[model samples]
Target: MSLPRQLLLGAAALSLAGFAQADIAIEMHAVDKSGVGKTIGKVVASQSRYGVVFTPMLKGLSPGLHGFHVHTNPSCEPAEKEGKVVPALGAGGHYDPESAGRHGFPWGDGHLGDLPALFVNDGGTADSPVLAPRLKLPDLEGRALMIHAGGDNYSDNPKPLGGGGSRVACGVVKSAPK
Candidate 1:
């Protein structure tokens, strides 16, 4: 019944309400030059104290670290790049609305869509959650989530996009239905 206690409760309630409004679930799938394949699982994206947390429930991926990112478009279909078909190329490049034009850490001054690498266990499942401190729920809309075929070094040296190689999996982040 104390005033301080009431203020604390009020703040907690407000935080929860804000988070509830910003949550989204993106369905992930295997992708290749053929296009999006069977459903792998889903990623539950939510707001946390530090930033947005992406908890994936994916499976059937190769073991080791894989590059993860938010691409500029919201489609997972394959597209023609040069003379070759690139899977998930319809998703465009990494979300760099500011024109950073380079790859960096999740909290660095580069692509706003840069995210921490995802780790796949030996059993071929990616259940570990990763954080993108520079991202929020609103930044995800009208974009696509991409998983690369290789690990990310978080640098542009000697390779582009952290040498993540090909796009192995993808998911589109659609707006919440009314």
Candidate 2:
């Protein structure tokens, strides 16, 4: 084969490999005391040079900043809290395998699940893509993706868990079969 032709084929193969390696779509939904509700949309997680990039294609959210994170459990069912059912409490706390026990920036030494705050437009849609520089595609496997009712200040001082309030929407991250 010609040298130029071989180089082009190699580049194309690399691009295809990248696509094959990046595939993890979590179907998000509205959650409440009852249970998981209507499907909001989906969030596609893919690999990037920096880290994992979560591209959200969500709607029907309160127009404002919503706290987003990866929770420890793989379930999004409501869990009982203080004798009352809580939304998405089954997802447990943020994915903190390292036991950081704190909420901070995506790149901070706190909870590895601490992600960037999601912004929903005035129309109640969230299409922005947030990058978790400290995460990889594998790190998100068998976890829960949560959208909080409020914003995340990336701190635990003024409020716990960045004062994200209740869990509004959630989705489980299931890995594609090999």
TM-scores for the candidates: 0.86, 0.86
lDDT of 1 at 53: 71
lDDT (Cα, tens digit) per residue for candidate 2, span 21-54:
4478899999999999999999988776666777
Residue-level lDDT of model 1, residues 1-178, one tens digit each, is 9532443343345445664233788999999999899999998777766667777889999999999999999999999988999999999999998999999988789999998888899999987667677787889988999999999988998899999999999999887432
Q: Estimate the Cα RMSD of every predicted model relative to the unseen true structure.
A: 7.8, 8.7
Q: What lDDT does candidate 1 reach at residue 142?
A: 88
lDDT of each: 0.84, 0.84
| Whole-model alpha-carbon lDDT for candidate 2 | 0.84
